[model samples]
Target: MTMAENGTDTAAPQEGEQQQIQMQILAQYIRDMSFENIVAQKGLHGGEVTPEIQVQIGLDARKRPVENQYEVILKFNIESKNKDSEDKMFLMEIEYGGIFHVAGVPEDQLHPFLLIECPRHLFPYVRRIVADATHDGGFPQLNLEPVDFVQLYRQQAAAQQQAAAQSAQA
Candidate 1:
């Protein structure tokens, strides 16, 4: 077997062939996780409780080629304010993430696996943690509904494409 000039075996990966991919959860961690109940007590005692809740969510993904793994992080911040008092009644923040190892997958499949599959796999555990933390913080259990990551991914992709198209047209 002769090595290519780049020192990699040229014959290893064949074109148009379906590679046997192996995916595993190498490690899952809340790398920089934080849950803050900014107005837990206030919400319970404050008069004119506001039913309005503001929620902000952010997502990020990073790949570690050396470990052949990817890390996907989801961050959320929620705030509830009293409409009358104009003061915050409840605040909750969660930063959760997961690590996945994917190998031998086709290039076309990698994005979906990371953006959709990995997050779907990790959501349950993250939801559990968030619920427990909120309950322990003197709030009702935050029973977050399951999220459809695939739909979310597709929506995001479509929005990006639309934006790009608009920009090009402009």
Candidate 2:
């Protein structure tokens, strides 16, 4: 019987084998980042402005494969606005990507490594950049806490499944 038919290849390397996994930052740049310090100037001048700030965070990810290497990007956007005046005070977007050279890993383990471990490794740098940019833009530092991507992925998947089930029932 061929390896394909058995769902397990005998020639596949065992877990913890001398597999090579390399994580490299091929390119890191701000795909787009914007910051508006409308309130900063006004506040400095003692102008009448509300102190309330509204922050919105967005997350996105994409995967690219080149030969045997994989490039995954985790994009984030943060927008802060003054709720009362409906004026945007701050906006920042970052696209962080890492290229991984992974081999001798079983197919089943690849998904977790890419979606969870790889992103976890890259999050600190991304968070730092965002915080620094916001601070340098004359606004308060925007230090975002680390996220549990595994739990997030599971929650999202569960929500999707629930929605699909409800739609089917409907």
Candidate 3:
């Protein structure tokens, strides 16, 4: 059978091989969420304020108590500011989680799989929530661009590696 670069077998399994990789989203929920309309809070009425938005993402994954179950949490921190004055316009924070039942993936690749694949499944929901929150906060709806999970994973991994190397040298 062919093996994929991510360490999963591509072709069908031969006799006596393990079952195919399986992943299912058993449950998904917004664990915590908050939206702040800083413009209103600060009473900042402006003249043709241009917005600059920053979005930050974090991911965490842990194995659940039950076998083959895992919990993945995707965290978002979004802030918008006036491009000229740099005054904060709005802030949105959310923690979205999913309970996944996964099987047949090798342990070596499970971490990347969870952090990358699971977030893709939950990003649409997170995007919608952010848009709704901004709209309800008296601002125009903010539609987030699609995330590049693979690139994010690679960048995070590189950062961690750099930190580890620096610490080791110290």
Candidate 4:
């Protein structure tokens, strides 16, 4: 029988024989960040200008094939607007990234590990960055609440499954 039917490749390294499966963080950094005080002066006075602050968070990951590494990026967007009007007070966006040297982790679990755990590890720093950026922008220090990445991941998975089921039914 040919090697194709036997599920063995003679031409390259096998997945089973790959090196030790350990995940290590090689580096962490701020990939990009932006803070804009739309009304720089109007929002500077600090007594009681109530603004509704809305924050959005997102996560992404990719493989660095050259070094068998993975990069996880956490995105945070915080926007503040006047409580009664539609005027924007301040908007801040921060993209935090970490380069992880990953080995020995199974392909089945890799996605979750990267999306959930990696960002969970990097969130505090990103949160501080957001706070600092806002404080420097003439606003009160913005403190972010803890993020539940596992819950977010579960929601995404459920949404995907629901979409697939709908399409299949149609």
Candidate 5:
């Protein structure tokens, strides 16, 4: 096996090989964003505040009118609350989207490719936005842990399969 120019492993070509897969990000942008500081709104002050944060993620993808183009969106919902009082500290919701031009990916693999790889490319920007939102909201900067896209994709696939089976039985 040898590494292709794109840094992916490829077997030495002895026969006519399929075209190499190609992908390019055409654009990335924040579709929507909101941040609210509940503590500030409530006029709370003066205490050692320990925060517990929850992060929820959702993904969506759709084919664009343009050929070989798809739009993928990653949605994030984050909430922080005081550990002791359980009062809400802040809330943030952001939807980040990317337009990708992808070609040569087999039809069966395209779904996973958009859901996993595209989001991975967009995550760092999302992280930075989250950190800034929290810090600028007058709280300690919140750095999100890295997400495991592969595991997430597998779980979603399993759930879909289970739902289909249940529906068929019903």
Candidate 6:
């Protein structure tokens, strides 16, 4: 057991060629983007005051017809409304997608890789889109906080397990 130059252990080849692990981004694009400033003048003035902004994040992965290829999408739904009034300030929605080539990753690691690692690679771009959309919509730049996809995935897994357990007991 010896450490490789990159700090990962490199095992001597046993009987066959070593496994290849690769994840490559073929392309990345904004699938959909919409920004609406509902109230023009009022919203602009109201925007001066702090608005209540809500953001939602979603991730999806689907296998492509091509072998070892998958499409990963990061979706965002952001809305801001006047803090003191019921009037709407602005609404923005974005869907950012990337085509990834994944190879040599085991089946057990596939789902986690797609959901956690793939999205981790795609999040910064999505965050920038949200900020730009808000700024273009005549509001102060709305910089979204960094997301913790690993924690989110764990929570989702726990919820699914609980639901399955409840169904089995029913």
Better of 1 and 4 by TM-score: 4
Candidate 4 C-alpha error for residue 28, in Å = 1.7
Sorted on TM-score, highest at the top, how do the candidates line up? 3, 5, 6, 4, 1, 2
Q: Candidate 1's residue-wise lDDT over 50-147, tens digit each?
A: 45666666667788766678888877677766677667656777777877888877777788778887787788887788778778876667767777
Model number with the top TM-score: 3
Candidate 5 colliding pairs: none
What is the model-wide C-alpha lDDT for candidate 6? 0.86
What ranges in model 5 sit over 4 Å off? Answer: 1-16
Clashes of 6: 0
Task: Give the TM-score of each candidate.
Answer: 0.72, 0.64, 0.89, 0.77, 0.87, 0.81
Better of 4 and 5 by lDDT: 5
> What lDDT score goes with residue 161 in model 3?
100
Which residue pairs show collisions in model 2?
A: none
* lDDT (tens digit, per residue) of candidate 3 on 12-31: 76888877799999999999
At residue 38, candidate 6 shows an lDDT of: 84
lDDT of 6 at 152: 78
Q: Which ten residues in a row have the lowest lDDT in candidate 2?
A: 52-61
Q: Against the true structure, what is every candidate's RMSD?
A: 7.2, 8.0, 6.2, 8.7, 4.6, 4.5
Clashing pairs in 6: none
| Better model by TM-score: candidate 3 vs candidate 6 | 3
Sort every candidate by lDDT, greatest first: 3, 5, 6, 4, 1, 2
After superposition of all CA atoms, the RMSD between model 1 and the true structure is: 7.2
What would the per-residue lDDT of candidate 2 be over residues 57-143, giving only the tens digit for each residue? 333444565655766667776777655666667666667776766555567777666777767877888889878888899777877
